[model samples]
Target: MQFYVGWSHSDALFSDYYSDCPTLVSAVSDNQGTLKRFKNKPNKLIIDCGSVFYVKQQKRPTLKHVFEIQRSLIDECPNTSSIRLVHFDEPMFNKTSLSDQYYAMERTLYNAYEYLKVVSEEKLPVNVSTMGVIQGFDRASVHYSANELKKMGYRFFGIGSLLAKNQKQQIEFIKYAIEAVGAENLHVFGVTGITQMAEMVRMRVASFDSTRPTMAAAYYQVFYSNPFRTYVISASRAKPQSDRLGEPLYCECPVCKENPQDMFIPSPRPYMRLRSIHNYYHLVKTIEKMKVGTEREEVV
Candidate 1:
């Protein structure tokens, strides 16, 4: 199991050793050049393009361009462990009563597979995992989408949008998908923070992703609250802040740990940066704790 962390649509930030946890980077637009930069880092990167809705809207590069990134990664980083492809957005099908919007997204996802097969045919040495996006605003929609994708040759599935909604409903959606696809082949998206860790782990997700660790401290200071509650607006900002905040306290992480309640500073935006760093540490530490607990349970 791995946590897809330290992600930015543009730059690299999880450079500190303490912040060095297994993370996944975006793989949009055949970003071989970019992937190569972090090639030797302690992380497994995934190429995450927006969802089918985004594809249809042309928010990212064309399907062909995304494949080109695969080709580039293959050509550049020959020794990397594996690469993941993500359809990174919510299912619009559940968003509206209109069937057209739903089908349009579905068709876009289908087209993605065709493109994936073509990329796979090129045959890179690394393992290629495809993420299945579950749709609908409710349990029924999630169930339907999961079953539909399982039928379509997806080995790994991802459940997004549903996570932030009803917890029971989200778990129900994940439980059903795992049952249909098998627990060993499922990955849950956006399962971050102290709130969802236990529940998500119980769901038996092979891996989960979040930006909490990178943003916790920033959130705490910005909101002047507890580490367990405040929300960090963006993950990109969290990565760097985690580094800066994790510095000094001999954090071992490039960004060491610091007092969560330090006064806000305008220069270098210490306040915001500290919060992000604090969030990253919290995230990394929490995951570590979860792993230790799981290991102990197996022993007992």
Candidate 2:
């Protein structure tokens, strides 16, 4: 699966190394020129409403909100390679009623259908691949959601509201959904992290986006990984690592190559940037390995 960068980060963190990977630009997280700037690169654009219900702590938007974004995307950024129609997600922590969850799912299908119908009728150039966001609380719900989206002519589905699930639950949802919707048509939104995803290399996914690696910067940590394992460099000397061995940290990553000594110092923001780059590199390579079924290391 190709990993897309989330919109909440500074674009400078996105190096030319990732120019081929599509980046996600959310209406909620990005300002003007972000999408256009990405458009100038080799990267494909993945546009979403950025309606991360739990992260933003908001209710599902009205059809008007969905329709407006659909129109705006078609009119303004019609060149996007992929467009995810707005969908309602009932966050697991919020404990929304089952009825409410089902209601949102129904509305999501309606929104997706209407959005596609308009795009087609308008003769918009967004005739690219479209993804329907799917949310559910159980196996049956997941299956139903997938089937409903398929009926709405959405062969690509983004499994949402899963960032909070444990690895097992996440795998369960993914496995069942893959069985229900077919693996070729699935894209996971905001996957948990590299390790969890690595465990899932047994399954194939079309694409996914993640921002958790960037959070390591805030927690005063650095991450290094190969496909099979991830290493955390705490820089606290609680454990013996190269920084304490009087050895230079060897890496070609922009941060490590240009700012070798910076890894020894513990600054949250810079470390976050460096580590986010480090983790993202591993993730991209990991997915690449999965694609070819050649495993020198495991990265998901």
Candidate 3:
């Protein structure tokens, strides 16, 4: 399974630190200038329309406008080996009404179809591919959405609008999508939890993306691997808890090796960035361990 670290403008300088990192950038948040910094880096990139950002907006950008943004970002990454472009998806986050949920799913499917049509007309590069965004509220709806995307000739699919759901619901919806469209080439958007990561590995998901490391750092939380764990930074203004750490753990990550004390500073944005980089290192290590364990189980 491929893990794509969510990238932002602030992460531009450190983006190249992890040579093997696959990145996911949102068109709604990142611009061509921000991506230009990655022009020389040969990382795999996923550019999504950032539907969740516009979910509450009364007016969203036109398909053509959004497509142009995505295209421009892709152009900025000339050295990237592979780029996946995701269509604008109407996220079904707070839509409690069944009708509202259905409308969101239908709108998502419509966008997928139109996006693929434009991609075909534009004749995007061989390395560039479109990912159909799957949106639904239940098992039946989820399967229907996946089937429609498959029928529209989407070889790669991603399931979204799962952030609001519980773990059980999230796994069930993912399973529903897999049942309709096999797990091969299927990516789950906005994954954060360790248990969920393990489940995805078990399911053999093609890929998933998350900004957990950055978010955790912003919230003064730190991550350690071996057996994945989180701790609140001891220097944070927030009340100290049992898991609070006064100093950084012994990590082999480049950032930690260079300045482990920097992670505990918790003030300057650059320090937070270093902490995020360190946290990301641990998360990737955890995923690697999970993958290795899964492979061993298969062999057994």
Candidate 4:
């Protein structure tokens, strides 16, 4: 599965702490300044409405408003792989009542349908594809959303409001959605969780996005993906992995080459950037291994 990193601002902002990743997921409304930098760029562009379209009275950007932003982004960046319309997801973890959850999901579907109708106009660019969003709290409702999106002609569907679920819970959710909408067309929104990356790749996820590697680095922690497991080590206790293991923390990563002796960076910005790069490199590599069942017992 291709990983699309959700970036809120210019990649230049994280340039110092760069992950060296190319496929970017940006909200149409927030990434205007960065959009121009990638004109005909080789990297993949994935656009979506930046925020959930269900905020309170004045705080909200309405469904129509989100669609307008999406239209504008598409007009400016027609090469994007796909763009998702407004999704009215329930609160994180889906804390609301089932009835309320279903209501919000239905609203999201209707809004996406309406937005697609508007973008079907002759004036809009046709190269960019569209992805609908699937959202709900329970099995039936989740399937309902996914199946309905398929019927509405959405080839790509983003599964939203899943950040709070555990790996097992999320797997179930993904399974249901996949059964309703083919796995090749599903994108798990805002996720590249460690516990599930192998499983997700096994399940044939079309793509996913993650901010954790960069976010953890910003908070003075290092995200390390070991051969057997993942670790988030605090920079305060940082040391050479060889201190105990008799080998380098990560000899192959650029970060390790730069900080060869200590295997730890004192400067926050550089440390964060290098850690992010190392983490991303490991994650991408690990999934490749899992895909072929190479050294399959290693992760366990």
The whole-model lDDT of each prediction reads 0.53, 0.60, 0.84, 0.62
Better of 1 and 3 by TM-score: 3
Candidate 3 C-alpha error for residue 80, in Å? 4.4
Give me the overall lDDT of model 1.
Answer: 0.53
Q: Using lDDT as the measure, which candidate wins?
A: 3
Say which candidate scores most in TM-score. 3
Model 4 has an lDDT value of 0.62
lDDT measured at residue 257 in model 4 versus the true structure, 0 to 100: 67
**For model 2, how does the per-residue alpha-carbon lDDT over 151-210 read when each residue is reduced to its tens digit?**
878778888777667878888888877877887788777775555565455587677777
Which is the better candidate, 2 or 3, if ranked by TM-score? 3
lDDT of 4 by residue, 88-188 (tens): 34344544666777677877788777767766763544556777888877788888888887788878888877877877889888888888888898888
Query: For model 1, how does the per-residue alpha-carbon lDDT over 203-227 read when each residue is reduced to its tens digit?
Result: 5568777755444443433221212
Segments in model 1 whose C-alpha atoms lie over 4 Å from true places: 9-12, 15-20, 28-32, 52-60, 73-78, 87-90, 98-101, 137-141, 215-254, 257-278, 292-300
Clash pairs of candidate 2? Answer: 217-272, 227-297, 227-298, 227-299, 228-298
How many clashing pairs per prediction, in order? 24, 5, 0, 1
Worst 10 contiguous positions by lDDT, candidate 3:
291-300
Ranking by lDDT: 3, 4, 2, 1
